[model samples]
Target chain A: MIRLDGVGQVFDGREGQVTALEEIDLHVRPGEFVTLIGRSGCGKSTLLRLIAGLLPPTYGEVRVADEPVTRPRRDVSFMFQRPALLPWRSVLSNVMLPVEIEGDKGRAAYRDRAHELLELVGLKGFEGRLPHELSGGMQQRVSLCRSLIRDPQVMLMDEPFSALDALTRTELSGELQRIKMELSTTIVFVTHSIEEAVVLADRVVVLTPRPGRVREVVDIDIPRPRSLGRNAHLTEVAEISGLLHGLLAEKEARPVDEVRP
Target chain B: MTDTKRSWLTTSPVAAVLLPVVGLIGAIALWWLATVVFGIDSYLLPGPQDVVSTFLDQPAYLLKETGTSMIETVEGFLLAIVLGVPIAVLIVRSVILERLVYPLLLMVNAIPKIAIAPLLVVWMGFGQWPKVVMVLLVCFFPIVISTAQGMKSTPVELVELLRSLNASRIQEFFKLRLRYAMPQIFTGLKVAISLAVIGSVIAEFVGATQGLGYVIQQSGASADTSLAFAAITLLSIMSIVLFYGLVLLEHLLLPWAQETR
Candidate 1:
């Protein structure tokens, strides 16, 4: 339900224009879990922003639901690297934010849905507690509950688990796969962890850093209800991971002048 | 670790109340000794007991003056909160407003508020209006600066998150930005209340018929140093109470603010 065509982004650096992305074309089908993976500065987040319509691309188009994205759509929810909960609000109130911002029209209606989502994320009793009162992982789960409460068409996550510890990250990634299976919502996630991408994503879009360009797209054909153990099919994961690594290594050996200066 | 302590002085409601009182007693003891050792005349610096006697001797009159000062302080502070917050919103919402007003704000705050007190008396006349205005002047800047800083500091990711939901500007401001700014605004308020007390007192020093400021000034001229000391103590008490009042309000209103920090 989302597409980007020949997109480019240029940020005004102190010296001159610094290219963040260029000639990037990506298409995501509805209900698809797509992960964009690359080293830092590969414009994974820049691409996410384009899809969210947070910034106007220097050149090209991003569209969702076959509509040219000019501004943020109410049907798209964005999750940041940080949980980004309002510290002054209770966990329940923070989850209810989208409902509150959209107004009272059906807020009373969504309150129950919010509670259910919190329960889905294992944060039921935490509803009355503040965000900080929760652990970092719990806080991010609350953020996930918040993003889903709107029944959004697309959820864009920018390195949501990057700041988390390894155990928490792995645990959350496993849960995210289950959540996706249950919710059946489209997600375009950004992350650096190959294991996380392998576990959660149906397809991984790898990009070249510095004027980010789509280097390759690796499809994970592994069967679902996937996890770090049992059903993940680690052998298939390892082969695909090695292939992706070779693609990155090939470029790293070259040391392209464009990337450095 | 501190929570496990059972000592009466450190573990109960008594501990919470006793610590500051102990500090006060120590300070009083030091002052008493200083006066005895220096053999200073009471006219120059009255001992703590002398100040207490002044308050005890004319309790009704002193309290009446305190009431007047309290009215001025609260009014000025409330007005600062009401006006300063909105002005901060305006500054944050518009780059033009921020550009035009921010430097001017710095200039206004930089100018000694005491220097303006005499001017206020000249224009506003020898009445409570001058004192209120002076308090507003002193208190207003910190509120605006801190609130604007808070609003501006609303994480870019959160802004993008709200934007992804297509929240209206008003919705973004009221729901996200304002709440994000609460702890910071309270910090400004805590700082400003103390300044507001001083502002009103300074205004009173230039010209006023009532308030503890006027009482202290009157006592100074009459060489009633103990009375002046009492007035100063009342002023300090008012300042401490006002500062802690904001702390209490912050505790009640933004319980979540304390956690993340």
Candidate 2:
């Protein structure tokens, strides 16, 4: 339940004003997994920041749960591309960080949830280990556990698994699907990979770069637990991925000046 | 045989301690040999044993002076941390404060600390206060610079994550920024501790009636070169001990930091 109406972002640059996004409208349904995909400088991340309330849009409004968002809402959580674990904190403590910041009186309850979330992500015995002791994939898993620890109404993930190896990325995508089945949280993910977008998203929103604007929103009819390898929906996955790839390639071919206006 | 020896030197726990001990003994032996072979005057370079016997001659007196110097060093170090860290936090939190204070701090730091030692004595008298102030002055810059740099280096993703969760500024600082900055802060601490010992000695050199630095000065006047060597050795020992103490503390407190590096 997130909505952005006519959202735009413009940054003051050393050269002049730089438009990041223009006349954007996007809505994410509750329990839905939406992935935003485009090339670099597409303002994909800028768009996410606007929704997270880390930045205010130059024009238009963002609403979450039917309320205008003037600042970050407690019921919304964001995940980053990097693991971003506190190097001094143990895995459990890092996961418990959000709750600690909230100063919640019910810490014991959150602690239990933290442990459960860690186990859900196959990090059961890693509670005492430091973030650096783990592999990159494992560290990202810790980050995921942290984001999910609060049980937020919406989770905004900005390419959370893009840093991992291909095999790990695929594995994490499947695990993410499993986790999504168990939780009703809406998710808005940003990514560079078309296959990742296709496999993970209920709907993939493709944006055009250079003052990013929504080019198309493609809905996937594929069943859950989608895989990149041999699966029942392999053809469908390839078809959608190929379509998005072509769309993105076509955008790149168009002259930069033609798209500027 | 060489390969096995090399591996043992690296892999065996005993080698870890034994190797450094061997190196130190070799250094001492070289000094003793040079004094004997060259028939070097003890006035210029006393043998290690001569220095040791000099310490034995008045163990109580030397130890008392050592204690005084140690007190000055620890006190100044503690004060530096107490003042330096908060100033760094203030600098990081506000651009206006950074702009106003940064150049001033640089100018203060740049004016050779030795040049200010006499001024400190003039202002605070020839007591322990001057020495303590000296230590604080020398130790302050490294702590502030390292900590400010560390706080400013927090990953943007983590900051965004906290913002999306509606974290307060204080919470973002204490929970994310400060914790993340700790490894670098400890780096500053280690550097400052060594400087702390030297700072106190420099102040003592200017006008103190006590401390190892004063002992060295007195020995120089009396042509008791062996005693001066003893005091110099003790100062080195103190600096080494304090530096390693911080290293040990960092190991215990931030085991994760070591792994990340």
Candidate 3:
């Protein structure tokens, strides 16, 4: 459902031009859960931004649903590391924000969907509460509901559960999998954690740091409802996680000319 | 103290009200004691009772003057919000306007407001216009600066989320930036309101026949030290009331702001 062809991003920094990403080619199938993982300064988030159309790629092109993405499209939604909720709005109001922004005529229908999304995320009684009243996990769940409110064709999530405590993070990852089973939306999630990438992604895209390029795309063949603890697929999860860790830790001394893949 | 008792003292609604009152009474008692012990001349520092009696003697006149000052302060504060918020929006929306107007705003804000009080009176005459203008001058900077800073400080993720949803510039602003900046904008408003009161008084000090500032000025000329003290007390009361009024408003309007930060 999404394609990036030779996409690159160059930022003008204080000292000189900083290439954030380079010579990137990626494709995400419809209903696929693709997670991008890399160390800091890897431009994983930059790639996501290019696809979201928040920032145009400095070179090449991005297409979603076979259309060139010159700007943000109506069928895609993005979520962030932080909950980023509007502090003055109640949870329900915040979930309805996208609909309100679109000035959609069927607000009542959207409102009902908002409640259902909130309920799906186990936030049934929090419609009247503000973002501050929620725990970190709960707030992120609210954000999830918000992004899902429009029932977009694609959702781009950047480290959505990384800010939570370890237990809450695991819990949320499980819940995300459950939610994904019920919704057909394609997802491109970015994360720093190797375990998280293995747990959530159908394919994990490893990216190199500094002028980021796609290093490897590892397809996860593990079954659904997979767990990190005492599960049938624990060995597979550990194997994939270790491989990603090694890839991230390698400090290759390749020449600049040889760096491009 | 018992744990529950200590918690009650810290958290009880009654304690919140009583503690400040006790502090005020203690402050008044210290002042009364100092006057009696040092045998200080009433001309220099009137006793609390002397000030109270003076206020009692002509409550009607003093209240009328207070009403006039209140009118000027409210008008100027409202005007500042009306003008300053839009200017802030304009500055945030366009880089060219921001660069052009930012330095000019800073230059205007840097010139001592009191230095311009006389000029305001020269331009607008001895009527309420000068006082209102003075209040606006002092109040404008805080509102504009805080609002601009707030708009600029919106989390990058939130902006991207809006953009990814295909929200228009106007929707991104009203539905996201404006609402997100509210807590900081209220911070500016609180600062401006206090300055608003002081600004009106400063204008009254330069040339006015009414207001608490004028009353204090008149009392100074007549050597009515007790009356001056009464007027000063009223001024402090006015400042306190206005500040708390805003606090209450913010609490009611943006209940999420207090806990989110």
Candidate 4:
């Protein structure tokens, strides 16, 4: 569904040019859930922006379903770490935002769908309440409902659960998995948590620190509707976790620009 | 009863009335004591009783002038809100426009509004229009500044989240940015209301034949200190009333914010 060909991002800092990512090539299939895992400043977010078409890549091409992405695609949606609910709007209104903006012709058309999305996200009675009135977890849920309102083909989530508490994060992770199953939409999730990557993604693509490049892609043999606590895939999870730990430690030992060739 | 107690403490009705009432009583007591201890001339510092008597004696005149002043204040204030909010949004949306126009706005704001009163009178003539323009000038900057700041200060995470959802720029502005800016916009409105009164007074001081400012100026010339004080007191009353009106609106429109605050 999405492909990045030799994509690179460079920042023209006050000091000098800083490369965030270099020679990044990847292909994401339809209905695939891919999580990008790396240390802070590994350009995971930069890569997500490239896919979202929010920023132009300084090098190479980013394409969605064979079309070059020059700008944000209508069929792709992005989610962020923060809930980012509008404090002044009710939950229902927030969810209805994309429809309203797209001029979806009639309000009645989107109303039922919005309600269903809210119900799916477990925010039923909260339709009348404003964002600030809800708890942080609940606010994030509203954001999730909002993102899913458009039913985009691909969902790009950048550390969507990182700011949430452990319990809420766990809950949302499970919910996301369920959502993936129901919708079967392609998703590219970015996170720092190894457990989060393992629990939520089919393939965890690990990258090295700044001037980020793919170190490895670890496939999770975990079955659907997976839980963090207990699963038949716990042993596989541990093995992947151990592998990621080794990569991280090795990367930390070397200077950022020094490759392990 | 404990639940009621909790509700009492948590709600705005009790705190709003109690705090302000206490403050007013304290202020009145100080004023009365100061007059008594200093044996201040009633002409220089009329007691609350004297000011009340002035109001009682010329109720019709005070009411008429107050009504005129309020018309000018409110008309100008509403215009400022309409004009300021859009300009603020534009400034936030376009960096080039913001850089070009914001400093100009700041320059206009920095000029003591009192100085511009004469210029406005000269341009608009010694009529109600000048006073209205004056009020607009004084009240406009804070509204624009607060609104622009409010709009710009939208949480980065929320913005990123919206972008990830493939929300168009216009969608992000109206759905997320505007809603987020509302509480701060109300802050601007409250500030503008008080300044509106001041602006009207300044215009009256410069050139006006009606309104509370005119009443105060005319009373000053006649050396009727009590009447001038009466006009001043009425001005204060108008200011307080307008301010609370905005507060009431914030309560109605943004109950969520009020609850959180």
Residue lDDT tens for model 3, A204-226: 98888887988878899999987
Candidate 2 — which pairs collide? none
**What TM-score do all the candidates reach, one by one?**
0.89, 0.92, 0.90, 0.88
> Each candidate: what lDDT?
0.86, 0.89, 0.89, 0.85
Candidate 3's C-alpha runs over 4 A off are A253-261, B1-13, B33-45, B94-99
- Give a tens-digit lDDT track for model 4, residues B1-261: 445456553477878779878889999889989999999999898888888899999899899999999999999999999999999989888999989998899898889888788888779898789988888898899899899888887788777667755667777777788987888999999989999999998888877888898988998998889899899988999999999999999988888777654
C-alpha root-mean-square deviation, candidate 4:
4.2
Report the C-alpha lDDT of model 1 over A48-123, residue by residue, as the tens digit: 9899888889999898999999988888889999998877778999899888887787887799999988888788
**What is the lDDT for B206 in model 3?**
91
Pairs with backbone N, CA or C atoms under 3 Å apart (clashes), candidate 4 = A78-B164, A78-B165
TM-score of candidate 3 against the unseen true structure: 0.90
The residue pairs in collision within model 3 are: none
Which predicted model would earn the best DockQ? Answer: 2
What DockQ does each listed candidate score? Answer: 0.69, 0.72, 0.70, 0.51
Model 2 spans > 4 angstroms off: A252-261, B1-7
Candidate 4, B-chain TM: 0.88
Task: State the lDDT of candidate 3 residue by residue for B155-191, as single tens digits.
Answer: 8777777777777888888888887888899999999
lDDT of residue A95 for candidate 2: 96
Candidate 4 structure quality by residue, lDDT tens digits, A99-157: 77677677796799899988988888889987777888988888888778778899999
